[model samples]
Target: MKLLHYTYRKLSLLLLLLMAAWGVLFYYAIIDEVMDETDDTLENYSEILINNALMDPSVLETEGTLMSFYKFRPISEEEAEDYDEKYYDSTVYIESEDEDEPVRVLKTVFRMPDGQYYELELMISILERDDMVEAILWYLGALFLLFLICTSIGTRLILQSVFRPLQRLLDWLQQIQPGKELPVLDNPTKIREFQQLGEAAVDMGNRSYKAYEEQKQFIENASHELQTPLAIVRGKVELLAENESMTEQQLKELDEIYATLGRAVRLNKSLLLLSRIENGQYTETEDVSVDEVLDELLPDLMDIYEGKKIHLVRIKGEEPFVIRCNLSLTQILVSNLVKNSLVHNHAGGELYIETTSSSLIIKNSGEHPLDGEKLFRRFYRSIDGKKDSTGLGLAIARSIAISASLSLTYKWQEGMHLFLLVKESEKKS
Candidate 1:
């Protein structure tokens, strides 16, 4: 859930609980007031009855069947002396209605003329009060529901407006690519915290960009500076190998030194290529097809590896697997993957290359699973890796893939090492 929705849920739940509690309290409060009023009416009516009974005793006998029902019963003197007034809720049967009706009842003892004791009871209907309470309860529930709905919507809109700056900042951060200059951030807000956050982000981005440029420049200068000395040393080794006066042992040592120099030169070149790729030096790009690059490189590679008798399997989809990237980098990336497969394969091993509209897959026969985690690290060589292998091929390929918004991943399955390359867009889809 989004932060806005998450916060709104908690607020709405709190509001719901509070409104329910208050509504219940308000409802009972109204009922209590109504009950007090009813009791007051009964007390006033009882007082009038008692006064009339003292003045004229016949009123008691004749007034028993009134609309507000009442009754009188003769009692002993001792009972009257100890009698107390009582009020409660009850039901009574009316012969005319043929059913029982709810009533508010009051009972009291009184002294009549000639010192005679009599008991008096009074009742009043309260059906209307019960109906009114039910209606109020229903209305209160509906009001609470309506208010809750309105409050929820209002809170959502307000939260959206309030968090607009943060959302924009997140989007701007996403647009930032490594080695690329930061875009201008235009998120203006009055909130102090968000303003500070934006400033911090921009400051950090500027510092990071400055550091990246310095590192990229240093690598380029170092690689180019070392290249001339390395070439001169290799040349001196070649000349040393040409001495006719040298012993066989000396010649063998010269050849070993030359081979070591060649390996060093290759390592330096790979590192330069990898640094260039990561630094975004190859900005020029075009639509390039992986299968096309393979077709171009495969003929010479196959001839070179013909001694291995490696079986080749190529599965091409009807549509070519194409992506937008520097044409040179794309070629290098494809060459590295294909060459690594060939160079590492055993005699009479297999090479499988499959290209779909969105991805490229290369699998080569292997005895054991290579370390997928360390395979892409620079200078990561397997135990059985060839002595002449520079071990930077996959690393350079991975750098190119990242710069081009592509994913390069490795896995081992069924005695084969598999490399998969895919566009980030196609993966999301």
Candidate 2:
């Protein structure tokens, strides 16, 4: 989830909980206040009736009147003494409505001037009050809903404005490349934390760019400096081998040294190529067909290993297997993979090359399977190592594939070793 949405969810939940708790409390408080007011009104009405009855006892004789609802009943002296004022809710039957309605009732003891004690029961209709309370509750609920909606909208707008700078920073970070200069961040903000984050990001990018430049320059200089010395050494060894008085033992030694120097030169060149590919130096790209590359590479490779009497088989799908990559790197990738197959194949073995619109597969008959895990590691030779093999061919192939956004995998099946290369886009599809 995005930061804004995540924050909003938590805030909304807390607000809802608070509103719910407040709503419950407000409901009870309103009801309690209304009940207290009703009780106070009932007490005042009872006092007024007692004062009127003391002035004229005829008012006590009137019962079941519209404005005055009360009943007077005679009580013993002991009963009047033990009586206490009581207030409660009850149902009363109204003849006009022909139904029962809720009311508040108050009971009290009053002594008449004739020395007789009586109980006074007074009731006030509360049906209208119940309706009023219901309306108030609904009004409160509506206000709560309106407040919730307004707060949600306001919070969303505020959060969006606050996070705009972070969004811009993310966009800037996406455009950063290993060899490219860092982009200028122009998102202005008043937030101190966001400003500090932007500064840290810019500093880190500059440091990374500097480190990358230094590493690339060092690799290029080292590779170039070693090339001349290696060539001179090999030339001297060749010249020494041609000496007329040199014995066979000495000549053989010179040849061995020359061969070792050749291997060193090849390893150095391979390492430099790998480094360049990783550094994004080969950026030029074009659509190249896998079938076309293999058509040219296999013929030359077959001629180089003709003494082994290998049979080459080609399987092409109806559609062409084409990909976008650096043309020179594509050629090197294909050459390395085919050369690896030929170098490890058994005598008079079969080499099968298959192509489809999405992938290329090469299977070669070998005496045994190569280690799948270590096959792509540089300087990893097979169990039965070849004298001329430098152990960098597959590693170089894998590096080229990665630079081209392709996947290269190795597997052993049946009695043959298989190398598969497929485009990442096609794999996803």
Candidate 3:
């Protein structure tokens, strides 16, 4: 996802969290106020009933059938004994005497006009309070759902306005390509940060494209310049060899000069290959099997190591490992890695090659230890000033690996140097 899209999502989530918190607080506040009012009203009504009952207990006791408050028939006289243990689901009961029962009693004493004794008993309905709480809860839940929906819509609309310019900027940036100028930034961004980023992006694109042009020109010019000198050197060596009057020492010296010139020519060729890979001239790609490439290069490897005591051990894999890549570069990358292993190995050391589902691994025991990080750097070596080694083996391997959209990694395990070639598809996971 793009940065603007991610930022908008986060902002919407933050707003949603805030709205939820505010809604919970509002619900609790309203519920508390409603409960307080209900409590006061119930208390006042209980007091009035108690005052009436004390003036006349006849309100609770009936002649034919005893009636309680609100004219509800009380239990029969025979059922009264068990009625004390029984409970009505909708009503609360209170008694006048003993005062040890769990039921609530609203008590008050009032003197009769004729000085007669009377006991007043009253019960309140607890269901009304329960019903009021339930209703408030139901309303709170419904309002919370409504608030959630409204916040969601509001968040989407607000973010759309805020991020519209960002989306445009992203589309513009993706359209940019190397060696091309950046498109003009025409978006009227309300956000200051986005405007600054747009300006920076345009500046960076121009600078990088210019640098790329300069680098490519330098490589092309240097390759051509080196080729002219190489041609002159080869011509001089041929003329010297054609001469017959030269002394024995002069001939040996001339031969050494020719060999040195040959090494220089090979080094220049390698540099030219490196530059070509860097310039991305080989854009053709195909689904190439790593094993097939390895197999095709096996004869060349055998020719190079013909006299050496190194044993080449090839462990074939059961499954086919295929990747979309440039064929020549892939062969160069794997060949360079395997050749580097052989060149650096100890005398009579074993060179091992194997493949996994995602990669090819080459391992060999060596006389020299390598700093893995410095191995890929141009013209860097762990040995003390060894001129026989070009030091470009790993560098070339790395360059080709990158061009093929693969990774070339080196590690040391159990006194053996391990080089891993991971295909691009494997790296995605």
lDDT of 1 by residue, 1-429 (tens): 988888898998899899989988998898788778878988998888888999988887865553588878889988887888988888878778898777888888888767888888888887655687789879988998899889888889899999999999999999887689999999999999999999999999999889998999899899999899999999998888887888999999989999998999998888888888877788899999888998999999999999999999999999999989999999999989999999999999999999999999999999999899999998899999889988899999999999889999999989899999999988888
What lDDT is obtained when candidate 2 is compared to the true structure? 0.89
**Model 2 reaches what TM-score against the true structure?**
0.77
Per-candidate Cα lDDT values, in order, are 0.89, 0.89, 0.71
lDDT of 3 by residue, 283-365 (tens): 78998888888888877886787677788899878875676778888788778887877777767888899986678989998
1-429: candidate 2 lDDT, tens digit per residue: 999999989988998889878877887887788789888988998888888888989888877565447988889999998999998888877789998888888999899989999888998877565686688778878987898799999999999999999999999999998898998899799999999999999999999999999999999999999999999999899889888999999998888898899999998999999889889989889999988999888888899999989899999999988988998999999999888888888889999999999999999998787788899998898888787778888988999898888999999899999999999987888
Can you tell me which runs of candidate 2 are displaced by over 4 Å? Answer: 45-145, 239-260, 305-312, 341-352, 363-392, 409-419
Poorly placed runs, candidate 3 (over 4 Å) = 1-138, 179-196, 230-268, 318-321, 355-358, 384-386, 427-429
Q: Deviation in angstroms for 378 in model 2? A: 4.8
TM-score of each: 0.84, 0.77, 0.65
Which ten residues in a row are the worst by lDDT in model 2?
60-69
User: How many clashing residue pairs, candidate 3?
Assistant: 0
Model 3 residue 150 lDDT score: 82
Q: Give the total clashing residue pairs for model 1.
A: 0
Candidate order, TM-score descending: 1, 2, 3
